[model samples]
Target: MTEDSSQAEHVAGTEHASVADRAAGGKAARAQTPLNSHRGWSPAEDRPDPVALLEEQNLTRVPDLVPVRHGRMMASPFTFYRGGAKIMATDLKDTPRAGLIVQLCGDAHLSNFGVFASPERNLLFDLNDFDETLPGPFEYDVLRMTASFTIAARNNGFSSSDIREVTLEAVRSYREAMIQFSGMRTLDIWYARMSEQELLAAMDMARANQKGKAARKASKALEKNALKNAAKARSRDSMQALAKLAEFVDGHYRIISQPPIVIPVRELAETFGLTAEETEAAVRDQLKAYRQTLQDDRRRLLERFDVVDVAHKVVGVGSVGNRAFIVLLQGRDEQDPLFLQVKEATASVLEDHLPKSIFEQPGERVVQGQRMMQAASDIFLGWTRGMQADRYLYWRQLRDMKGSVVVEAMVPMGMTFYAHACGWTLARAHARSGDPIAIAAYLGGSDKFDRAVTDFAHRYADQNDADYQAFLDAVRTGRLVARGGV
Candidate 1:
């Protein structure tokens, strides 16, 4: 039997069990996998080479842009970790699980959590990236998140104690929040979400509680910066994209050419020996297929716009070499513009070590996972198969008031605060699709799980440093080519 089927059978009847029975089941889980056993990490004797794993992934990416991915990852160990989800997934599979499951973010590093405009036009803080999402042990996501804080904190030159404290805050907040969720009604848990205003107010309260003048001053500065970024995000819409990326040429608006990073479709069509008209027709066909995946209302809304232009756009550090394109559409008139991003969706990295996803198409797996995890998702979210065989793609607005914290500039206190927020948000997301009571009960009412995971984070950070050095060595010896300043 498949791993997913086996695991599903393990928890099959627990959902309908009494609360007391569920709690007992959680307690019983400790016998099979003790919480303290989660501490420490050691590469197995047969562990795969991390650099080789990255090179394997590059084999599937656009050859010209693979170096860009390498260069981006070579920026720092933290950046490498961001793109090393496959490496971590390999390592995590050897670790103990609580036998509990959740729809995982799969790559739940610190940067993946961010604020985006929900369907209701409200700014909501949630998991913003789902390219590698899948169902797996709940701890896998938590470990990935906590380890991210450790790597990021170290990159910022945080002291050992400060790093430990920050990492602990993330896991602790998750534990405490899960306990709270365990008591909430199903509907309340579903409705729970962190809004921008609520986040800002929380920051304000935290700043006010700082004890010293310098501390409070620093806190206030971070708060102000966050507020400024939120306001900036609000202005980052289709109008902004049109102003920055589109221009009038030959009497019509077309996407401006910025080769390697943003190449117009006409340029790409020539590379493949296809005419511009033929290329645009293929793009339109993909859009029509994607529209069918959307709700009736969304499909109607989409039909009002006409495709104007398309371009190849490289996006995100980890997703650099994947097939990604920006589609320009005009509604009513030239002034009404909408930009939709169509990105290639590959199988989740976790699928290598865990159960294969039930969804056959990778694009549908991503779309369904995002819809299940987020409290509210982008209105334009959908999926489609590309013209080429084995190419699956998902579509969403290019921008909708999206913003993320700049981890490089964060201080210890700022990181701790951010960690707490991430931990709480992750717990809420897991609560939605997993059994909060059983998972929370398994965690218990102590810092034991937090401390154990923190220990694992420290060890994993060391391993990441070693792997990063190996990657740099590969680039130096001509085993890998990296183009910087792209």
Candidate 2:
């Protein structure tokens, strides 16, 4: 592989280059070339089918990752391919692109953005998950983000013109924010972010003035669930909300009671070289890993808390077939429980387009990159490896004041609020990992990039529909082997 090419199979000195990077890197560097011009590989032997890729894995290797009985729940053909992150990534791998390889939220669907509580007890909002975040052409993120916007608009019965306006607004905000950052001092851009006070005050002004339908909608929503509500949710209601999903396995969902989620903790003990009585030691090791993930100051405060209950719980569609666990900690009292998530690590879809790290662990890139990108991130956010056969990252809280707007429930203003939120957070994320000023300068004082993404979004939405149909065809023809054990 060409040493200069980011995703060239990571060969040290091989001649084979990634299909996208074979270009001498001039026009692409100038951001003048169309990104999709590099169709990486469309080999006939590559299957070109997402379902096939999902079927090829042993499902049991990362048993915690897979849904317990998805096949049966997915009885209808339409929902069968739901939450298939790897499948989606594999399909995209059929075509790779070139240009500025900032880290991407590989599957940047509109629904993935949300609000969650930070360790400082503030209700901070940003991109809520990064299971698929990795470095690749920034365009992939734009493409994915816009595609989700259109898909969401269509689902909400918006006219084409209205949908276009909403999505164009999203891209415009991102482009403009990047430009704004470019003119700032380097360190200013480094620390630049949309603060909670900034958001709350803006909503207050919007509410007082009735700026527009979108702003009014957002103000009303925020007013209904203000900081007081957030505080209650983070501290008082989090465990109850999590327990809502649990069942009475002999009174409660304890390790010995639940088979799968609890079963793995024992395996964790064995994998980490600890005995049954050395429970504190094993848990302490995981806490260390979690601490190292936080920014220095936050780690010190975490050192004081005593971990209370830890459990394995199934979570998320794209991550259904991956390992996910939660650890609850009590600092001063039982009321102060902090929940942390440890998700499995897997190869990135952008792996074929990003630089190889000396670190062999797969998901470290995602967890670290996510923290870097997010303006205000979960302090409990961190990663660990060697315990669950493969590596994984640990992050805090499942539903500690964490919430997302339902696509169907979105009104026009809600869409605008969501779009603006995405734009602001995306710019912040890009700033954290790359030269945001350069990106800002590239996008200065124009809607050209915004319009380009809207155009690309329209075209790619059609492509997603086609891909969705392709998935349906695979199911109809019995090409996709499934256990149907929902």
Candidate 3:
């Protein structure tokens, strides 16, 4: 709660400090805004209710699916963290920040960092979700990740000391990686990426000094699991999607519907209070406008496919209540099918708290931000406005070999390696979008900042756990409704 000169300068006015101001005064900025000073956490007495915040967010989402969203969040504390980005953002709005701006993953939890196919058909490990992407204080993403690791490790029954170590490793990796990036050439920083082999090597090195039989055994199992997951991710392409979600019914490809998760367009129309005829026509028009957003080659390539089916598909925890549709397009024959997800992109949760996006459309904001922060993006990535409803939707392949960590299943050794990977990826992402030099200077060559953030993570994770318990009580008392659990 104590403010330094820089903090006082920032808090005294409504106007934000200029990037130029910080660029010329990295060390001064560090002096003015010491990380060690902002290590503790205490929620304000006026802190808004978490359930109320969630209900406010649910106002813009699909009414029928909001219960499911609550259900997913009720599953675990880490799951709550995934869906509680808006809540945390609101809380952190009044907290002290270092004033170093960057494009935040906004919901930078451990599960959000994953392996996906690069355009060149190679597996790349990076931050994969951008639903809440926006320009904000770099610490927002760091805090989100650190707290996520702490909560996730705690869920797996790790001891408090072990959890602290995991959180420290993550923060340490991020600081060290940012420092490395600061000394690299601009192009080299841009080109720097974590490959599959590099990830395995990192795991190997982290566990190299372990001499215990149980430790070695756990390390080998962890490596094998990671490799297997990566391979599984690589196989989850359009064809795999077709096999899982579609079927050859009466000599034609049709998306199989499993209600509450996948409902065909005809059924989805009723939820919108629209007739089937009106729904199909509206979707057709949306696709036409969507083509214009694509590049010439991609647009031409899309022209070869004929839209056969569209269905409402429920996805991730935070996105459960939002409008998400998957379109099945047949190319050449039934053998060549492309599944494109048309997901609704609303105003980012960070929009009100951070610098507003230059792009007018929310979908465009997401697309542009993803392109800017990601080392490589989806080939078919684009955005379009809705025809039937007032919505902004981004279009991309539903599954481009996307694979994420199941935190509950991870052992201590796997958690450590995964935490480091997440930290390294987040640092690279920040370096790509913001001034790495200023950030690196602020972090310095010591573990002071890392330790400070580790302390913050522990306190925030405690907050998150308390919130999770409150949510369960709310559900039990009929104050809030949750449908099912995992």
Model number with the top lDDT: 1
Note the Cα lDDT for every prediction shown.
0.91, 0.59, 0.84
For model 3, state the Cα shift of residue 482 in Å.
Answer: 1.1
Better-scoring candidate (TM-score), 2 or 3: 3
lDDT of 2 by residue, 151-263 (tens): 67766778888789878878877877766665566567666666567767766765788777876776787656555544554553446744653333553343333554344
Output the number of the TM-score-best candidate.
1
Q: Is candidate 1 or candidate 2 better by TM-score?
A: 1
Give the C-alpha miss distance for residue 144 in model 3, angstroms.
0.6
Alpha-carbon RMSD, candidate 2 = 6.8
For candidate 1, the TM-score is 0.97
lDDT of 1 by residue, 364-451 (tens): 9899888878889999999999877788999999999999989999999899999999999999988888888888999999899999
Checking candidate 1 for backbone clashes, the offending pairs are: none
Give the number of colliding residue pairs in candidate 2.
17
lDDT of 3 by residue, 1-486 (tens): 122223222222223445555344566667777879658878888999998888889999888898899899988898888899888988777666777777778888898889899988888999888988877788888988998899999898999889988999899999999988877877898888898889888778756877898898888888888889999999999999999999798999899989889999977788777798988888888888888888899899988998888999999999998889999999999999999999999888887676666678989888877887788889889999976467899999999999988888887778888888888899999898777777888888889988998888888888998889888898999988889852
**Full candidate order by lDDT, most accurate first:** 1, 3, 2
The whole-model C-alpha lDDT of candidate 2 against the native structure comes to 0.59
TM value for model 3? 0.93
After TM-score superposition, the amount by which residue 397's alpha carbon in candidate 1 deviates from its true location, in angstroms, is 0.6
